[model samples]
Target: MEGLSEKLASKLHKYSVLPFEDMYGTVSPLDAFVFTNYIFFLIIAFVATLVFFVVAANKTALVPKGIGNLAETGVEFIRNLCVDSMGKEGVKFVPFIGTLFFFLLFANILGLIPGTLPATGTIGVTAAWAVMVFLLYNYIGIKKHGFIGYFKSFVPSGVREMGPLGKWGMGSFIFILEVLGHFLRPLTLAMRLFANTFAGGMILGIFGIFVVLGVKEISAIGLLSSGLSLVMLVIMYAFKLFVGVIQAYIFTLLTTAYIGGALHADEH
Candidate 1:
C-alpha cells in the first residue's frame, strides 16, 4: 500500500487534486488585503456578468443592436421560460432567476478557459446555490401560508379527504414521501452540477498527463496517443460548454418549479 501510494503520488501528485489551489489566501489578517482563493473565479464571473448587463442596458441603439439585442433575447427567453413554468407569479422572480442563470452560465463558461477554475465545479459552491434556493422557496412558502400551513400543503387534501384511508394510514405515508422529495431537491441540484464539472476537470487533467507522456517519450504509439488525446480534449471542451449551459438552464428551471410550488402548493 505504501509503495503504491508513493508511486502514484510521484506520478500524479499535482494533477490528482483540484485546480487553483495556491491562489486563495489573505495578504494580511485585517481583511483589507484579504485574498480569497477558490472564490476568485466567482468574483471574476460576477464582474464579467455585471459588465455585460451594464453594456447591454446602456446601449443607445433604437432597435436593440449588439449587446442590447443579446440582452433582449436573453430576457425574452427567461421571461417566457419562467412564465410558462410558474404562470404570472413568475414575473416577480424573473430578475432573481435570470441573475441566477447568468451567474451560473458565466461560472461554467469561465472554467473552459485554460488555467481558470470554475466556482460551480466544487460541491461547496453548488451546495451554497442549492441551499439558497431551497431556503428562499421555503421562506416564501412559509411567509405566504404560515409554517403549519406550508408544511401541511405537502400532502394533498384528497389524500386526507377519504376519511380513514386518508387519516388512518395513507395520509401519514404520503406526507412522509412528500417531505422527502421536497428536501431532496437541493441535494440533487448540488450533486448534479458538482459531479459533472468535477468529472470534466479531472478528465482534462488526465489528458494533460497523457499528452505530456506521449510528447516526452518519443515513440510512434506515444505520438499517436498524444494526438488523439489533443483531439479528444477539444471535443470534450466543446461538450463541456454545452453541458454548462444546459446545467444552468436546468438549475434555473428547477428553481422556478420549487418557487412556484411553494407559492401555490394547492395548485401543485
Candidate 2:
C-alpha cells in the first residue's frame, strides 16, 4: 500500500487514493461509510435549495433583492429551458430538472475548492443518478401509455405502412436498433458527465504535481517548472469552471428531453 502510494504520488501531488487518513477522509469496514460523500452532497444540495426558497419566499420583493434576484434569475433560466424543450407542460418537471441541475452544478464546482473532492466523478454516484433518471423516464412513459403500449411505442408503424427501406426486413431492424438506442441513453448521459468531470479533476491533480515537486525540491529548475505549472493550473481551472456549468446544463436539458419524449412516446 505504501509503495503504491509513492508511485501514485510521483504522478499526482495531492492525489492519493481517496480516504487518505486526512481529516476530510473516511474509512469503513462495510464500504458504506466512505460513501459518505454522497450524503455530504445530498445535504449540501438540500441546504442550498432551502436557502434559495427561504430568501425568495421571505423577501417577496417585486423590485427584487440580493439573493432573490440571483435566485429568480436561475429559476427563470431553467424554466425557459424546460419550456423550450418540453413545451408548456414542461412546467411540471421544472422543479425536478432545476434541482438536478443545481445539485450537479454545486457538486462539480465544489471540486475546485482546495480540499473538496467531486462526488460526481465517482462511478457509483453517476450510476445511481443514471438509474434514477432511467426509472423516472420509463415510469412516465409507462404511466402515459400502459406497459404494453409503452413497449409497442418502440415499434415504428409508419415504416410498416410505407413499406419502404426493403419493406418489412429493414423496418424490423430499424425498430430494434431504435429500441436499443433508447435503452442506452442513460448510460451515455451518466458516463459523459462522469468522464468529463473525472478528467478535469485528474488534470488539476497533474498541475498540483508540479507545484508539490517544486516545493519539495526548492531549486531553480523546480521554481521554473512550478511557475509554468501554476499558469497551466489557472487555465485548467477556468476551463473546468466553464465546463462545469455547461455539463450541468446539458444534463438537465437532456433529462427534460428524455422526460418529454417519454410523455409523448406515442407521438413522433
Candidate 3:
C-alpha cells in the first residue's frame, strides 16, 4: 500500500490540474480549467435559442399570442435594423445577423444564472465570433464586387471624385487611414465584448466572496456585510442583464452596418 501510494503521487506530481478540470487543460480555451463550464453554457444558449424559436414557430396564433408575438417582434426588429443599416438589401442577411444576436443575448443572460459561466467572457470565444463577422463582410464585399473592386471600395467615393492631384495626394492619405481603421474592427469588437462580460462576471464573483465570508459569522458586522453583498449582487445581476441585451444589439447592429458598408461601399 505504501509503495502504491508513493508511485501514484509521483506520477500525478508531474501534472498540475484544477479541481473542475475534465480533461487535459492544454486543449481547452481556459486551459487551466480544462474543459471550462463556459462550453456547456454555450450549448445551453444555442439549444435555448433553437427550442424557443421552434416552439414559437409552431404555435402561431391569429392574434399573435405569447411566444409567437415575441417571435414576430424579434423578426420585425431585425428586419428594421437591417433595412435601416444596409437598406432593403440587408433584409437578406437577417437570419445570419439574428442568429449572432440571439446567441450573444442568451450567452450574456446565461452568465447571470446562479452557476453558469458566460461564454462571451472567454477571449477565445469572442475572438472567434468577431473573426466570423470579419470574414462574412469580406466575403460579401468580394461577392458583390469582384475581389479587386472590393479592395478599391475601401477608398471612399469622395477620394475618387476629387481632382487628379487631390485624388493621388489627399485621397491616398484618407484611404490609408480608412483601411487601418477598418482593419482594427475585429480586434476592437472582440475586446469590447470580452471586456464587458468579464468585468460583469468579476463584479459578481467579488461580491459572492464577500457574501460567503460575511455569512460565516454571527456578529452584526457580519450580518451587515452579508446584507449589503446580497443586495449589490441582486442589483448587479439586473444591470448585467441590461448590459447583455445592449451588447447583443450593438454587435448585431455593427454586423449589419459592416455588411451594408461592404455591399454598398459608396452609399453606406
How well is each residue in 135-220 modelled by candidate 2, as lDDT tens digits? 99999999989998887677666765665554467767877897789779888888988888878888887777766766567788
TM-score, every prediction: 0.86, 0.83, 0.83
When sorted by TM-score, best at the front, the candidate numbers are 1, 3, 2
Q: Write the per-residue lDDT of candidate 1 for residues 1-268, one digit (tens) a residue.
A: 1243444453334322233445222233344433344467888999999999888889837777888999989988999888987788888888999999999999999988887776788676789899999999999999989999888788788775778865748878888898899789999999998888767776776676677667776889879988998888888888888998999999999999898888888664
The local distance difference test score of model 1 is 0.79
The best candidate by lDDT is: 1
Per-residue CA lDDT of model 3 for 1-268, tens digit only, reads 1243444343333122222354433343344444455666778888989998999988887789899999989988999999998887878888998889988998898777876677788777888999999999999889989998887777777777889988889877877887788878888899989889878877777676677767777689988998999999999988889898998888888888899889887552
Candidates in descending lDDT order: 1, 3, 2
**How big is the positional error of residue 94 in model 1, measured in Å on the Cα after superposition?**
1.0
- When superposed on Cα atoms, how far off is each prediction in RMSD? 4.3, 3.9, 7.2
Question: Residue 226 lDDT in model 1?
Answer: 87
